[model samples]
Target: MEKILVVDDDLGIQKQLKWSFAGYEVIFAEDRASAIAQLRRFEPKVVTLDLGLPPDPANATEGMATLEEILELAPQTKVIVVTGNNDKKNALRAINLGAYDFYQKPIDSDTIQILVSRAMNLFNLEMENRHLAAVAPSMDKIIGQSESILAASRKAERIAQTDISTLLLGESGTGKEVFARSIHEHSLRKDKAFVAINCASIPENLLESELFGYEKGAFTGANKTTPGKIETAQNGTLFLDEIGDMPIGLQAKMLRFLQERVIERVGGRSEIPVDIRVICATHRDIPGMVAEQTFREDLYYRIGEISILIPPLRERNNDVVLLARTFLAQYNEEFKTKIKGFSEGAIKAMSQHKWPGNIRELQNKLKSAVIMAEGTHIQAEDLNLTFNNDALSIDTLNLREVREHAESRAIRNAYQIAERNMSRTAELLGVTRPTLYSLIDKYHMDDIKTG
Candidate 1:
């Protein structure tokens, strides 16, 4: 049930509209103060507002004030104005003030309904798109040129052309979500909504309603009928982040929706058709989860039609310097600093560090360095990546050998610090469990095993 606030002084018009819009939850406000109070309380997505109010019934002043107030309170709300036929100038002004649309009053139910329905649909669509974009990875802010990142970019471009579900698999802070949005922008459905939801962020009980939506009275707090993320993403892309955290029960429903391209509201009987392309990302071993029966096999197959593995920053040669320079320029402008670039020693330290937290960690370090560095050049000390005299003397000869030694040492340290907890060890090392398992395989470290 979409909630609509009808603000008009005419009692007869209000009564007729209230009864007619049986499909909606209608709230009425007869005066400016009452209407504003209702607006603050209800926060309706679509409002039918009369430009003539009690204090200034013959003029548009009071109505315009209400319109401005509504906009300030909820910038996203769609307020449709109702004005007299002769008040064309005022109606135009209302539109400029951000009214969704206007209806010249001699109130006809059919016409009003048409206008209201359109406004409601558009409002829902916009809201859904915003949600999608929020969840999907956006690449607009990411700056990089490493071979690994470039390869991932190429893959993302190709994946965007098809409507196939893509799974971005990587460790945390590797910019998996950024690739997801690049896919959206490059895809054919670029104009449509790009909806994103994080399985890990939302609570289990509310997750289903957030994804599948609910009809009025579907749940304790559900006061109106609403389209879920899936419905909103119709003809668009839906990005699900940290998908490994989705509950087992909801996984089944999501799998069903993926298979059938339809969903039923949590408490609704009707199946709503949806036309959405799904993209999922996680720092978990989904295949392992499927084998363990923690995640449904069917959903795994559906979401991973194509899987793209994002290489960690440490693995992407030369990308560290490239990204650091980019971030340096960005934060310099952001922080209003005169820092030119990194010192040669700072660059060396950045290249040599393991980058356990990957790109995100590097970004934070650079941001801090830019803010704290007093001189034009950022030094290794400013970046907090100190080079111990003994560690620095280790021969730079045999680069691959050096990397293997670093990887082994980091794994061993992480395991010992985590008390042999594989999950905690993997997290400390800034690698996904699967990646950690691979390391365990490579290094033959069975002694460090922990469930």
Candidate 2:
């Protein structure tokens, strides 16, 4: 049921309006204090506020105070002010203060009811639109409007229309899965399933079977015929995450599947034709892997037909704060907390630190902060960011050197938090596990023990 609050010092007008809007669960507040109390308690979506309340019934001060408090408490709430005759100036002021609409006194029940209902309808529609947009597949889910991410998304959208294999190359936590899903959603195969699998998660010996399935008794533990991930993804998309970790032996098989659009199950001689679009992602340097003979050159060529490189979180200016706000809102709804938003220091720390772990790291940190935060706003200390001190330090060399230093610190902190579990660390940092491993290799931080 929609709740509405009517705040007026006039008992007769309140009674008339209360009985007029009998359909709604109406709340009454005769004074500013009680009005605010009712607001915080009821959290009404619509409010009919009279600008004449106790302590200032002759003035608009109390009423304006109530209006500001209501907006600050719930900015989304729609408030319609009821003013006295010839009170156009105060009505306009109330509107400027964020009231939805205003009505002149003398209380036409029919007219005021229409205004309240309209406000309710508008509020409901906006809420529904927000809910729908959240579930809808759009670039909005990418969560950043930074120049780099926008440019990457624009390229990704164009690549989505093509049927050719497209590889997403990015450090872990950069939302490679989100990019792949976005591609699938925007592509012709939007209605089909999007199957995602981590190539590195599966063991070397069992990875092939997991990809191409196995016939009964194919291996000692293979007692039943099972379809592999590739076959299961028929008529849809197969997102090969962490493709760099795929064993060299299976890389040839994957390349063949891409070439011929066919696969043969383990211990089965019959060839099974599969129709699917392939989108692979990796944080590794495929060229380096190819040179090292660790990843197949043919497969690399096939998957890299089109490549989208996702920039690290630190490089995307202002994206850290954007993503943090988005995550705070998400977790607030999930946890049913009234966390208004992040504090100034939190935003500063987020903006200054090198997000070595990327979006994923930001998400985890925010989730923790939201849950652990004592007040309505999340502070920098709540994030437990190790770079907080460095961000405040004035002793810095060149800009590039400072950036590198911050990046190194963020990476080290993320590694410690994940206890050096590359997969978990990758998750914390918002990169793929393989990407985390690659970072470990890049930074030569493998000697760091899992905390």
Please provide TM-scores, in order, for all candidate models, with all chains considered together. 0.55, 0.62
**How many times do residue backbones clash in model 2?**
12
User: Which lDDT value does model 1 have at 79?
Assistant: 90
**What total of clashing residue pairs does each candidate reach?**
6, 12
Residue 386, candidate 1: Cα error in Å is 1.0
lDDT tens digits, residues 1-451, model 1? 7899999999998998887677999999987899889999988988989999988899889999999999998989989898885676787688767787677666666546656776788688668756745765444444555677767766776677798889999999998877888888878899999999999999999999999999999878888998888889889999999999999989989988889888999899988899888999999999899999999998999999999999998898777987898789889789987665665457667888999999899989999999888655687888999643225335468654465557766887888899888889988988667557545533334335533
Model 2 residue runs over 4 Å out of place are 1-138, 386-451
Most accurate candidate by TM-score: 2
Q: Write the per-residue lDDT of candidate 2 for residues 1-451, one digit (tens) a residue.
A: 7899999988899899998898999999998889889998999999999997779788899999999998998999999898876676797689767787777766766557767776898799668757856765465557665788888888887778789889999999999999999999888888988999999898899888989999999889888999999999998999999999988777788888889999999999999999899999999999998999988888889998989889999899777886787788789889987666665456667878787888888999999999998754676778886435455446656664465456556777887787767667667778654444433422334234422
Clashing pairs in 1: 1-224, 1-225, 132-194, 132-195, 132-196, 137-177
